[model samples]
Target: MTGAVRLEPVDERNLEPLLSVAAAEAEPEDVMPPVDAPAGWSLARRDAFREFHRASFGGLAGPTRTAMYAVVSGGEVVGMVRMTRCDEPGVVETGMWLGRSARGRGLGAAALRELLHAAAAAGMHTVVADTTPDNAGALSVLRRCGAELREENGKIRARMCLDSAIPIR
Candidate 1:
């Protein structure tokens, strides 16, 4: 059976391990911004990945504050989830990606549940996520999390209102 999944704060100590999982079990595009390197994870790409996480923590000084978490399961770092403050007050945008080896195992849903809880606890009134229509795995997780989904242009957007008094699922 798959182990229970949890979200731990992403920090210096665990960042390397998280990057290792991303390099070995996930495509760089799925986890980071587009890189000009070769198809595989290259040296420059790895450095960029580290910088991305580093910047995520610095969001507090900017207009948008972002919080990132390492997706942990079975005592291993398998993915990441993040919540970013949106331009709208009381609203936050969320995104997540799991290593290929960890996909389709209900882990994404579990991580999203934790992310939603975090959002509510952070005093967010709404949470939103956007993905392409072809990303079936993401769509499934959003639906399972009770998000209201709609397709606009070529993107599928999911939104959910937070109510801390009630449990998610």
Candidate 2:
């Protein structure tokens, strides 16, 4: 695992690259089907899926509701971490993905730690994450970050409580 990756906030100019990395890392089985699919629907029907993420991450006030950070190594974006639906004022849910080249490096764990620290500084009480039962890597990262695990509805849910004294930097 390389020890030199850095995390930075996502800005409007970086959304396209972030999406491109996410798409490249996705597998056929990773695509979630629409809850209500029409019969004989084609791939184009998945436009809504892309739009969902686009609207979530793309906008002038991108940091208001959702916060994202890029993991950079050697001056290039190698992965990203995101915190969404942060309106709770005391909790946030986080999601992350690392590009193929960045896998096996400790960057995932580092990024998660940074996110938790940021959340704590923002006066958040809990930081939550979820992963499919099969994703060992993500589970490992969450565990390493002191997340308490729970199983429900076939998913592994994890959470960490923040210590209020830490400063956000």
Candidate 3:
């Protein structure tokens, strides 16, 4: 990570780079819907990956339900972050995944800060996330962003109030 981490709205222009980064840097299971095939980026998995982003990001018509962003670091797409509106008013559920190389360099935390700022600007009152207990990196980032964590049904749920958050610049 050479430059400041930033979130670029997912669209046709940058979507390919984001996908490329994902295919090269992160595991398929970690980033997209799991394919029941082998353990690598197969053609089916690649197509599925593209479709997943396009559908979730709400292609052409723009983000209808989820706001997805290409996580760029050092002027390159390294990962992705997204937030979807929840049933509760003024609340959103966020999820993010970074490439192996981008982890531990504070890019995840920085991208998360940007996501929180965006959520707050979008009038969201609270942000929530979930991860397995074994994912220490996600846990650390969530905690750093002021999320209160609790174990529920074999998963860790994190909740953070935007009112008290101070997003990193």
Candidate 2 wrongly placed segments (more than 4 Å): 1-3, 28-64, 86-88, 164-169
RMSD of each: 1.9, 5.0, 2.4
Q: Across residues 1-169, which tens digit of lDDT does each residue of candidate 3 receive? A: 3336889988888888988888888889889877776678888888888777878666223555788999998788889999988889899999999888888888888888898988888899999999999999999898877789999999999998988846453
List per-prediction Cα lDDT, in the order shown. Answer: 0.86, 0.68, 0.84
Candidate 2, 10-34: lDDT as tens digits:
6656655655665566532243335
TM-scores of the candidates are: 0.91, 0.71, 0.90
Cα deviation at 94, candidate 1, in Å, is 0.9
- What shift in Å separates residue 149 of candidate 2 from its native position after superposition? 0.8
Clashing pairs in 3: none
- Name the candidate, 1 or 3, with the larger TM-score value: 1
Candidate 1: clashing pairs of residues: none
Candidate 3 Cα errors over 4 Å, as ranges: 1-3, 36-39, 59-64, 167-169
Ranking of models by TM-score:
1, 3, 2
